[model samples]
Target: MNLLFVASECAPFVKTGGLADVIGAVSKSLATTGVNVRVLIPAYPAVAALVATGKTVMTFDDLFGGRARIVAAQAEGLDMLLLDAPHLYDRAGNIYLGPDGKDWHDNDLRFAALSFAAAQIGLNGLGGWVPDVINAHDWQAGLVPAYLRQDGRPAPPVVMTIHNISFQGVFDGTRLSALGLNADQFTQQGVEYYGKISFLKAGIALSQKITTVSPSYAAELLTPDFGMGLDGLLRERQLDLHGILNGIDLDVWDPETDASIVATYSATKLAGKTKNRAELEARFGLTKSDGPLFCVISRLTSQKGLDMLLDCLPDLLAEGGRLALLGTGEPYLERAFIDASNRYSGTVGTIIGYDEGLSHLMQAGSDAILIPSRFEPCGLTQLYGLRYGTLPVVARTGGLADTVIDANEAALLADCATGIQFAPINGLMFGHAISRTCALFAKPKIWTAMMRRAMRHPVGWDLSAAAYLDVYKSALAP
Candidate 1:
């Protein structure tokens, strides 16, 4: 089986969020399954440095409507074809922004170039390789499936995965003609969303099959609030859509092997975890306490429910626990956390920007992780926290609901349960859940049991990649 992956982000080369993590892990896993998997992405400036150090293969000429030079480069033992259109991709900072700290106004054409380039590569032959199945991720690659379907080309089957529905690429319908798409495509059956050309909608309407990151998220998207105005379209293709829970690369996140943490520990030798907690407290200048240490490592965006965290802080502080946070987003929320840090200097510490090393430290040191997201499509931090014996306290939504089960519930909970779940996203509800967790912590035996169980929770990509393989096979079948 030959698979071609089209995505905006991939780890080590380029990354902005969970999307990169998913693409990189899945592609590598599929390769292990004996499928000839290849990836296509824009050759951003940061990744160009790798091309200088690695062997570059002559791919093919992308003759969509004009000339586009394509180059294939190998990295981390994986084959990746980088679309070299300096006019469109070569810019200063990371993707979605320039040096001016503003979104590039031409992102529509830039990613449109990516989709068309990838579509042509599959058809015209890139590096003498052709894909049996073309998998597209997010709105950036959304237009490819639509282009393949509407252009009447007997191309490879397409499977479009919706990592998050909130970021549908909607632009003016006038830009359609520039890409040689018909003007009549502005209707409901096409890229139209209200009066805009929604790139995600086009893919959802045209792709052979669709999938989200988690099964619960698949059900959530069918509702009015979580759908982001595309629920009806997903409903129309319900039979072809699936929800596959994402997996984490245990090699990178495993506590015993991780060098970032102060001490190494696993499910068997749990005593080493206390040294990590002590180191974390010393690093953050928190006073030593036997109380459980809680941490929240996420963006301070409204979507992450940072506002709710603020509202719940006073109550949480009154619970007599220490807290540390590591992430940056939304200036107001950042400032609010800073102010809270000042108010509770000894008990709370806030580090604004994200540090991957610090994330590992927190996971290894903290007794619990908080994720009160407004609506999380699929959260990776919770999975990382679980693997590190950090009990996750999350709201009942998206993958958080799907992955974490209550620690105090059923008979099998001793072996499988990992975290706590709150019913609502409000402050009081979150505070109540925290209190219940504190009550559980008072019982050291149960807490230790829960931590061991959480550490044993399996979320590897083997099962998820197998499920995706099944989806690809079905999509390719006549």
Candidate 2:
């Protein structure tokens, strides 16, 4: 079957988070199963450099106040349809934000245009190759189904996948006409949310199927806690929703073959991992320790529960554990972590920015990875840790709960314990989780066994792609 993916970002070319990785990996994995996948992403500088040289399949005289065209290209082993609109997509540094550190004023029009283009492609096949199914990812591509519905054409079935429900593309309801939204469709039953128009809600309300990054998150979206104000609509469309777990690109994340890490290692041969750990300590200016070395590779946001981690840091250091953190987000969290690094000195080392290579080495080197998220929509770092034999210490929520088998006695006895999981997201529990991890690390035999088990865990996309195919088949059903 031929499939088209409409997403804001894709791996290697442009990425702000796991959504891009998912798009790139899913396309490749689905292709292995005989699915012809084409991803439609904005022509950011990196993508434009490669895709601008490809065939121009479709052009627009005027789309959302600018001339635009779609360039079909193949790069990095993936087929992509680049929306080459410089006026909308061309900028330096961050793609979504301007130099002023605020969202670009034209974001609503920008992504709406992307969705509008997708609707066009769905209605009129590109280059005589119509997509059998269109998978719209995140709120950026949320209006694809709505645009198709507005066109009133027999379009390919659209599957709206919510990578994170918190980022719904909501704007003024008064700008419905500016967005080219049908005035008649502005009721509560339509794209209307409170007094505004939410692109994510429009997609959820109009699409044939809905999916989240993980099954556990799929269930979480039904409750008020995780719904982010759209639980009512999600409850209404519960039958159409699916919770398909996400998988990583195993080839890219493999510890043995990854060129980004300082040393190569695997489940069977873990000697190199020791070398990597030493190298990681040196990079972060951290002191070597006999205790567990924990790494955090994530956005430093409250939603990630980094503050709680800060509270547990003193205890972690008191227990002889070491930390190496690499990420940037939220001004306060960044300051706090920096402060901790200074106060804790050799025990805590923090990098205030993101480095892809450093992240890979951290996973390869660290004895464990910390992901105590208050709420997670299927984190990919934990999966990468699992693949690298770095046991994950995570919160018991969303995909973290679904993926990691806690190192409880039952799981340990079965020799299938992969990582540590803590519940009741609070400082006390988080501290206990850290202490528990330290205790587990003290047991060398059990710790090594768990690492091997984690490395053996299936974090690849084979099963996930097959599950996506099944969803597509179901959507195409008469």
Candidate 3:
């Protein structure tokens, strides 16, 4: 199987969030299954530095009216093709955002060039390397399917995976001609979304198959709450849609072998976890206690339900629980957490930025990881928690709902529970869940069993990669 993955970002190269992690891990996992997977991403500064030895494979004269070329290189054991268009991708603080913390004005043109190049490769092949399936990820590469369709040629099957529907890449319809898209495409049945061109909508409209990060997210996107104004169109393609739960890279996330954490431990031998806990307490300058230590490693944004967690902080401290957070986002949220750490000194510790090493330590040391997301497409932190035997207390939404089995009476009795899940994500419910987790923490026998069960749960990409292969095969079917 020849598969081409087109995306804006990829991990260990250039990453903003889970989308990059998914593309990086899934592409590698698929290659292990003997599928020839090749990835295409923009040559951002970080990516260009890594692929400095990469050679130019093909050059195009009229790609978005600029001299664009494809540079083939190998990174993280995967074949990568970098779209080397310096004019479009060179200046970057963030991939999509400028130095002023706003989106670059020419983002539409930048990504349109990326999608256009990907379409050319999908349709005509690069150096006789035609892909059997062209997989476009997120709004960044969403126009690939549309560009291929507009080529009016028999092209490889296209599949678009919506990592997050919240960002639809809606642009002014006036820029359609500049993007090389037909004026007629700016219609209700086409890419037009309320008189705007929605890049994600174009993918949904033109791709042979559509998939989201999780099964629950797939169902959620069919409703107005999660669809971001594309529910009706998504409903029309119900049968063609799929919900494949993403898998974590076990080798990188495993607790037993993680060098980032203070101590290495497994589900069987958990003594190292205690040492890790003490180290975490010392590092964060928190008072060491036997109380349950809860960790939060996520973006401090409203969508992540950080506000609800903030609201429930007093309740959590009242229960004699300790909270530790490590992430960076939303200025107000960062200040709120920092203030909380100061006000509730020793009980709450906040690191207002991301540290990869600290994240691993937080998981290994904490009793439970909290993910009170308002809506999660597919959460990687909870999956990492499951692997580390750090029980996740997540809201009942998206992949959190699918991956976690709530430790209710039925689940505990059946011995199949992995973590605690609460619905109607709010301060009261999240606090109640934290209280429940603390109660469970007091029962060492039951809590140990749950931890073992969580560690035993499947977190690797084997099954998800196989499911993706099936999707690719289905896309190629006559």
Please say which candidate is ahead in lDDT: 1 or 2: 2
Native-to-model Cα distance after best TM-score fit, residue 97 in candidate 3, in Å: 1.3
Per-candidate TM-scores read 0.95, 0.99, 0.98
What is the per-residue lDDT of model 2 for residues 386-453, given as tens digits with 9 covering 90 to 100?
Answer: 99999999999999999999999999999989999999988889899999999999999999999999
Worst 10 residues of 3 by lDDT: 57-66
The 0-to-1 C-alpha lDDT of every candidate, in the order given, reads 0.85, 0.92, 0.90
Model 1 per-residue lDDT tens digits across residues 363-391: 99999999988899889999998899999
Those runs of model 3 whose alpha carbons end farther than 4 Å from true positions after fitting are: none
Residue ranges of candidate 1 with Cα displaced over 4 Å: 53-68, 99-101, 411-415
lDDT of 3 by residue, 1-478 (tens): 8899999998878887788889999998999999999999999988767557998887888666578789999978879999988888988588898988889999999999889989989888888889999999988898997788788899999999999999999899899999999877777767888888989999999899998889999999999999888899999999999999999988889889999887899888988899889988987878987779999999889999999988898888888799999999899999999999999899899998777789889999998999999999999999999999999999999999999999999999999999999988888899899999989999999999999999999988999999999999999999
Please give the RMSD to the true structure for each candidate, in Å: 2.1, 0.8, 1.2
TM-score of 3: 0.98
Instruction: Output the better candidate (2/3) by lDDT.
Output: 2
TM-score of 2: 0.99
The Cα error of candidate 2 at residue 434, in Å, is 0.6
Q: lDDT of candidate 2 vs native?
A: 0.92
At residue 109, candidate 2 shows an lDDT of 91
Candidate ranking (lDDT, best to worst): 2, 3, 1
